[model samples]
Target: MSIFVRLLEAIGIASASAPPIASRPAPVGPIMAYNALDLSDPGLLEMMRDGRIGVSGLSVNERQALRNSTFFRAMNLIAGSIGKLPIHLMRRNGKLTEKASEHPLFNVLHRKPNDYQTASRFKSYMQLAALLDGSAYALKIKSRGAVRQLIPLARRSVKPQLSDDFVLTFRYTRPNGTVVTLQADDVFHFSTPLSLDGLNGVSLLDVAADTLGLTIKAQQAAARLLTKGTMARGALQTEATLGEEAIAHLKQSLAEGYAGANAEHDWLILEEGLKANAFGYNAKDSQLIELMKREAEEVSRFTGAPRPLLMFDETSWGSGVRELGLFLVTYCLMDWFVIWEEAIWMWLLTPEEQKTFYAKFNEGALLRGSLKDQADFFKAALGPNGAWLEPNEVRESFDRNPIEGGEGLPRSGTTAAAIAQADKPDDKEGSENGA
Candidate 1:
């Protein structure tokens, strides 16, 4: 253990063990249900475990609903895109030299963090937070005097409580139920602030709560329709009086024979004068499908994720997909990238180091256009009026090695002639004067 940890332990500020069952008392005040100030609230952990959402009208848990819905998959795609990209530190002069680029800071970032998580895992964790919870948090683990590792904190594991002095402190609960009190500086927080509590972020669930609730209700209704037989709606009519056993047998047989997708085309026979009379067959089916479509589209619209991404809008295809993809990167993903970049710079780097170095996400990886688009872009970039990037830079985009003599730009005739004339300045001036 580090001296810092030992010092904290000595001062009785270290993480305390989980209290005994009898020792834990009932909470009080407005935060009575789950004490926001306390890290290891059993109620909080139980809510997380059950995936319970207090938001009314939702039949399902927020986390489960997000996973089951297309929005979660779209979020995964966005998160994965960012997580796979190279995020590195650049020097003040904008060069990525060995000293600046391959610093220990970057090594900790790109390699295993605290000997447990991979670089990709770390980035993905933050990405998930930015998308779903509107915040990402990390515990800054230090070795000696310098910051060494960053451990990503689960969104459900930590709660940020604001004191009367307007100071922020984190109440983090470990997996073993140990609650640790950490100062704001000890935790790295990246938040998309929508309220006064800048430490905690607004959940996407909270924003799309009503819509999600409606979605769940719609899904439940559809499941009921399917389980009760999609085509076999309405009631069974009979002229002859039936006994309780006969009615029970008939109900069971109908349910087993025609109830789910697997029993769709099965023969549903009603003996003993019991006739099956179906109602709302066509209208209900169409309405159910339409309701689902509308709900999915609503989710897409509210979340800023494209409807086409969730396969709800077939109209947006080909070039429209590309346009939407670019739009998503610019509007949705770019904002998230900035949140992460700024947080990393502020939290990871010391005040002095922040001046010399800054962290940036490689947006080019996310925004790279089509082959034709890239060709045109590179052509314009290498043109006489453009600031020509080296051939190695272009080759790197194509995942190819640089060729010898490819560093120099292919000069235009006008540029070459201008250069030649400029070299012979005296001759050029004399010729102009004689003329």
Candidate 2:
């Protein structure tokens, strides 16, 4: 029995036969250590391969720290927005087929991807990790030569390899001290800013660390002030003489009484001619808010996320919101959509099937506007002078069932030329009356 069969059986899947092997003894070549660690940095790859490095800077830990931040949480809006979109499978003739979309492949992707996480969670994690780490992996689970389900692998545990024959394989470390190798055909490796050699992706954190780190520091400083009462450039002064121990006791007492949310508006009695004075402004100071806002704006610019989408600017109203939404869908979301769609198309469909089948993200669904706005847009689209879409076609977009006889092209209002032609007598009738 092979290790894969044992694994499947351990997962409660009854396996009757051994899995088929497609790999030709990985051609005795140099093993590549293409992990999440920035390969662009020399020696890091070697260190990771030799187990010399463990969670360095910009590690998965840093990614989590960013998630914990206020401004960093705003970045998640991009991934969350795009990840929930529906992926449709279509044929070469541009026909969407239920067979393809309802296939087990999509069922696993759209509903239950793994035993632990839903499709939404899997997609959200995959997209965020890919954005931060520049690469994400999904291990293909198969039984008896057929793919059963896709399991998302932790970005931290996967080190990929590109063999001389261009065969991609991954070395994944499990939580129970077991290691498994997966073929490229068995794994869905999604990446962004894919390198020219295609061996590894360039981490966005590596490129934008200075910016992200600054925001992180600001958050930490604010947390310290809020929780530990370390007010910026402020200190307590006393006129009465006191022993060193008493002074230390007073400071600790003040901190205990006036720290965190519990300290709001709480009065403190002082003795020995001690008076409280505040020098620095509170955290609500516009300057600090502006600084954080500026940093957030810069991060949004780098990520191509709309400022309005992140709630950075509240002044945008009505059409501004629509325009910003369009900008997000066009400039930011579409790029990621294309990346995911291409990856799915290439991997889910074989070479022969690729000629006829493809995948696409439903961009129209994301680009939809308000009810009134959509109605007006559809009216213009269905107008006879500029007729583009039929009434039924428009209704289908709103998920409303098409009406009978609604497929015909609409007619334009009466024109002066048409009225004149109607009033004129027929030439053949006039000639027959004369004869």
Best by lDDT: 1
Each prediction's whole-model lDDT (CA) = 0.68, 0.66
lDDT of 1 by residue, 25-112 (tens): 7545443212333446564344544543435444344565665466776677677867887677666764533236456677766666
User: How high is the lDDT of residue 119 in model 1?
Assistant: 82
Off by over 4 Å in 2: 1-60, 67-71, 94-117, 142-148, 194-197, 223-291, 314-318, 408-435
Best by TM-score: 1
Model 1: ten consecutive residues of lowest lDDT = 29-38
Model 2: lDDT of residue 68: 41
